[model samples]
Target chain A: MQQNNIAIKVNGLSKNFDISESGKGFSGKLKALFHRKRKIITAVDGIDFEIKRGEFVGYVGENGAGKSTTIKMLTGILVPTSGSAEVNGIIPFKERKKNAAKIGVVFGQRTQLWWDLPVRESFDLLRVIFRVSQSDFNSQMKKLDQVLDLNSLMSMPVRKLSLGQRMRCDIAASLVHNPPVLFLDEPTIGLDVLAKESIRNFLAEINREEGTTIILTTHDMNDIEHLCKRLIILEDGKIVYDGETELLKQKFVHEKVLEVEFHDDGNVIQGIPGVTVIREQGCKKWLTFDNDNYGIGEVIGTIASRYKIKDISVNEPSVESIIRNIYNNRVTLAMPSEKSPTK
Target chain B: MESIKIYIMLFTTSIKARMEYKVSFLFYIFAILSFYAGQFGLLFILLNRFHEIKGWSMGEMVFLYSLQAFAFGFTNLIFSQLVNFDKMIVDGEFDRVLVRPLSPLGQVIFSKFEVSTAAHLIIGFTALYFGSRYANIEWTFYKIILFPVIIMGGVMIAGGIRLMVTAVAFWTLRNRSLVHTVIFSSKEFINYPINIYNVGMQFFLTFIFPIAFINFYPAHFFLDRSGSGLLHPSLEMGTPIVGIIVITVSIFSWKAGVNHYQSTGS
Candidate 1:
């Protein structure tokens, strides 16, 4: 994507909140009412980034890291204390209604559908709200059905549906207007494997076929790995890292695990350089070696020549571990080559 | 035009949902009837014993009581959501309305319809007509035409007051009891004759809160009696216009409140 093809641009966005942390009790409540001291918290401290059209971006952060605040600012729900953001060429806060018509938002913990109405009725209501033409509504519903598999869940009341089923419907409702931009805040949180897979596939298909620009904030590493090509990581209300997904992994993950099984019960291989034996049993041992320090082939050759090995397997660090390492500030790996192709 | 249709659909859906539980619906109707009937019965016994209080006959007091009751019932029917606005704000449901294309106040006002309150309205109107006949007010075509205008204006004033109270919730999250005091205090003031109060208190009701215009001035005109020798025909007809202005201001305040909503976090 070209830099000038930006569909969403955020500059110097900041949000501060006065949080009162009064303890729980009647006396605590009274103290809060009379308390003179106030503590200020900067939720989003001057974050800046741009998202090009049709790009799938993952926004990752720890709790209280301003991920939700950034999403709210982009979606026109909260006004930033300073700085500016525009979605589809409209200032989100100033032109909230127009911006809302051009963007779709879904928070995982909340449902926009009417609680007492069946899924079909809520869709009808949404169609009216968005002013979707009959032909357009039909086409959108057909596309959503094929992607989300929402046929069986239409007749059920929203409150009666399972979390996964409800999330599918919620996604469909947000897209009733055929918004060009979409914001998903932890859309796959608390979902089972099957449900997560379905959502991931649906999101991928939409971004690919319809050219919908998607900004997803999630704690699920699999969601980031499978859906996003570009990734931004937030920490302490700041953008600590922003680049391609592969680069984020390669830059933060330097170690690879090696699981070795010995033919003899008493066989032990020690004195291996540049590797740590994290775990060991009677005939098996797990060793972690920095890939930057030693090649996998060289390490395996040294180990095999020394001991009679039954089997040896190398494990690249999972995306979850990579992210945890970055957050923990243990070590920084080199950035991957930028020539890597997008899937 | 589309908003009117939406309101009708919302009201119909609320009625259907409320009727789904047959036993509860019947119980609600009975409970409202019994409660209002008991209050009316106590007023009747008091009027019977006093024969007349401060030169106002029993039928005339009933007219005042019925007028206040009718206006209260109409407001309760249409604006019951205002009474529970604090809950809606705290739950973050108001954020949903703000995101929609329609005005947030329009959506919140039409979110729920209290059909059960129509029972009280019907009862109040029945008493008003009977009380008018007993008081021997000369029937005229103009009076008949003006009755609906008075009722609608009364609804607007009461609804406007409720709107103002609900707007405070945008700043203070939980204060429905404060709203109740604002509503009930006005109702209590309007239940008796405005003439019984001193000039200062009467002026406060007429200008500050404006509860007097809701029923008292209109009732004075319809009954063809001056309000303690102070009513003027021109002012009697003009009181409801003040209500229209108050309702308009309330609507503007509601819009300001929507702008000030700071939505809660997940």
Candidate 2:
């Protein structure tokens, strides 16, 4: 949202994985030791983006689209093969400990907290690791307790908690250091509806109140819709789109759907300008029209004059559809340079 | 200082978790004791049948056996994770250790402490005491003090070797067979006196892997046996220093291995 105050900046970062051509097993391992055949797969191709302080950005991509790889590079868990990335003004891979100290990362598929220890003990251990002062630790814990409702779960062993409960505790554990940047990889994955809602709300509140810059990667479209204003779409190890979330939907979705109910059983609107009948069943008609070419009012007016319309409703394309369109390479959203205002 | 506190906390928590299965924990202790007892019984039977082997008295053999046992027990107790290194790497558990602020080696070494191995230590000490009495060696203060130093050196050498083997797993990804070869071969060398082997074999064992530094060389020096004339006077007097060198090299290798760690798929 702001320039030159970037909390995270990436410049042409990429990673390549060497997969043994012989495949995975004892034979492959032996083959890899000597006279090996290997294939180089690029997990993250060169791509760049910048996120300002206090921005919530959703990094969305399909499976094997390098979302996790990009996150790992950002978090300093994996080194980039080429190019560079900085979080909070420090190069991540070069100054990993410093970067780690300034950021919190949570992978929903895995828990970083000690399994046998109680949630509170795990939090305390994290505090010790991060070297948080006592008063700051307590205040942060209090904030986490209020936001995540962690009191009941704190005393329970982490291994004994349900997935949702563990996830809430994990978020709390990650935040104990009061890290300015937070990386959440599929934080709402495998969560129930209510659990997802609570996590989403807590994340929003923290980003707003604490000004915590967040980079969230999730396959779930709902998380993006609910939490992030900015979205970056990755496909085949490259960024296909990066812009405001609403702009993506507007740019990609060409047609809008209109549902009409006829007052008379036999009444029908055969055709309208820039509109195609999607389906008709039992006096209800679903029509699709190019939003860029025709306004909903003009379409509705034409439909009403042609047929006895009793009720009508219009639906814009959903975020899921827009993402799917990106994944299928059906639409191209404008890049930042292309969207810069003309002189 | 903070890392030490965290390590202690981790150690205590792991012990508590292990104790949660009280029956299994007790059974594990019993099993280890019985295994060591069985080996001791065989040693007793051998000593009863034969007066000595290679000009070495049964009591001296006991000293050698005890030294090896103590060294192996202490190494296994503190670094048992090394024995299971392949499983941790394959399961991606090493990723967890990497994320922690503390050294990954420290976390792994302290992750699990085998309390059951204490039984081996007790049995080894008992055998050493009885053997000393039977050997009827003069109770000089220097000889007495040298015993603990020898045992500590033995532990350090064993730990160093184990750490090196575990470190190899970083590159190899699987080292069970390699570990088995190294451990069993070293055990074969340590089970008997180093003097029994030819000079070249002695040099190989002493200079290369240094399994002899753990028990044979130290035991020979303590008993005033065959190795006294062969080794350099300073090296003979500084066997513990050799152990320390081995340990330092092993740690350096481990650090290098960690630097080369290419973490598995994200």
Candidate 3:
């Protein structure tokens, strides 16, 4: 029996692409036309996960880590080579149109709206296409306007809007049908800090207040840090880590860094307890200590007593650094449900 | 019915997009109109010089050209975007279309329109009127009734040809060469009566590619020409049936292509 609470479920989902032989020059291309040698590339290896209703999950990976491929399978854009996937309890590839009505998708690099049409006209067309009633359309547009500040940009053609404005409209357009699930592939890519921040906030709000299940994939760690409650990291077409965002950080990163600047030059203080000096350059010093074994005050007091510290600051391992450590270390994180993770 | 409404909405939006550069658009329209008229003028000069080819008069030739032009133009207006199918697959437009609550074919159809085809449409209608006058063809009630139906059938045949070539792009990821040779240059076969060509070439055009259904075979009906010298007499009335079969097969091929699709990388 399929559960009503599950928004998305995937088991052994995979997609393989047949890439045609690419020859070098004119004659080579001509030869490839008739010879027809093909190589198969597995974009998404077998993966399993289930997302509950209203959960905000970040799908993160390196450039070719199958993040976008997984999202494409869920959206019914590409049929998987093997395994099964269900969105809102409907098989997406089999009943694509049915699945489409229940979900909304936005590709950050591509605009779903008509490029040359006015923003309002595009939304209105989408409303009719998605079978959104007039009252519901009105309410959705009103809410989108408040959240995305879309009123000023409605009259302009989509091509005329700046990248930031177009991205905002794309997000607003995705929600016009008020779909219960939204899939975003690299939605924050190539945006400035402020633009990404607004998109991040809007996504977080929509996921929380409207109870919409969102799966976002991005290279920006800040997007994952601020918007996602859960993180699922992919490495070379396989899931490497899947758990709460906080939990992944805690499991992978434990040591914290503290930096101190001494008033006197060339001061590399030694013999500090509970904290080991990791780096020394000029009058500045960096120390590392396990957060679990020593308190922040205890580490700081040990350093200050032995040396005259002019300025001091403590650093917790940021989500970016922690994720970098995971990717670099090639950590094979155990699935939390299968077993408790051990170092 | 709702699909029709959405198509109209998208159609008008397309017109607005073309209206963005009014001066350049008008210039393009003018260029196309004159270019077609000039081609007809050259044909007139050549026919005046040769008098007739295979006993077919200049008027009959012009009429054949006009019918083919109108059918080809209507198909071009509707299905020219199929030529860009590779771009859609590579540039994420197909991905966007698949995720929407609409038929993928319908979405692709409504996404873009070749509005400049109005030039071919206008030239086709006017030349057709004058060519019929020159040919002294009598328009009986049945002939008049069948004229619009024949034209629509002709459009379907040409559209199906374009669609089949486009379907090849799904696996190939590019169809520029096919679009040029099959959808474009192939239409030149019906510019004259098929009987003008040799038996082998005529068989290829009539049975193999079947571009003759687009104009030549059907033109015999309106011209009051007998099928005595043709391959088969019944072929003159083959437009509507040939059209239905070709489009159905092409659509099936297109659907299969979609099923076999592998979208480009992100």
Candidate number of the best TM-score: 3
DockQ of each: 0.40, 0.40, 0.72
The C-alpha lDDT values of all candidates are 0.81, 0.81, 0.85
Tens digit of per-residue lDDT, candidate 1, span A1-343: 3544888998999988666566569888788788834678888999889889999999998998999888887877677888988888888777777888888888888898877667887888778767788899999999999889889999888889999999999999999999999999999989999999999999999999999999999999999999999989888888988898987666655678999998886766678888888888888988888777677888999889988899989886777787888788764434443443321
**Model 1: runs farther than 4 Å from truth?**
A1-5, A20-24, A35-37, A263-270, A280-284, A331-343, B19-26, B38-55, B139-142, B184-186, B197-204, B227-238
Model 2 backbone overlap count: 0
For residues A1-343, write the lDDT of model 2, one tens digit per residue. Answer: 3544899999999988766565479987787668777678999999999999999999989988999889888876677889889898888766666888889889888898888777887887788777889999999999899989999998898899999999999899889899999999899999999999999999999999999999999988999998999999898899988889987776667788999899876765565779888898988888899777677789888888888778899986789987887667666554322332211
Estimate, for each residue in B76-138, the C-alpha lDDT of model 2 and write its tens digit.
788887888777777767766665566678888888988878777886887688667666656
- CAPRI-style class, candidate 3: medium
Off by over 4 Å in 3: A25-31, A269-281, A292-298, A330-343, B228-230
lDDT of 1 at B106: 68
lDDT of 3 by residue, B120-235 (tens): 78768866886698787899999989988888898888998889889898988877887888887887777767887888888788777788887788778899887733457677
Candidate 2: where are CA atoms >4 Å away?
A: A1-5, A23-35, A94-96, A261-270, A278-285, A308-310, A333-343, B136-149, B197-203, B228-234, B262-266
RMSD of each: 3.6, 3.7, 2.9
- Candidate 1: TM-score? 0.89
Model 1, span B51-164: residue lDDT tens: 565666667777777777878888988888888889888887776665665656767777777666777776687668766866777769998888888888888899998998
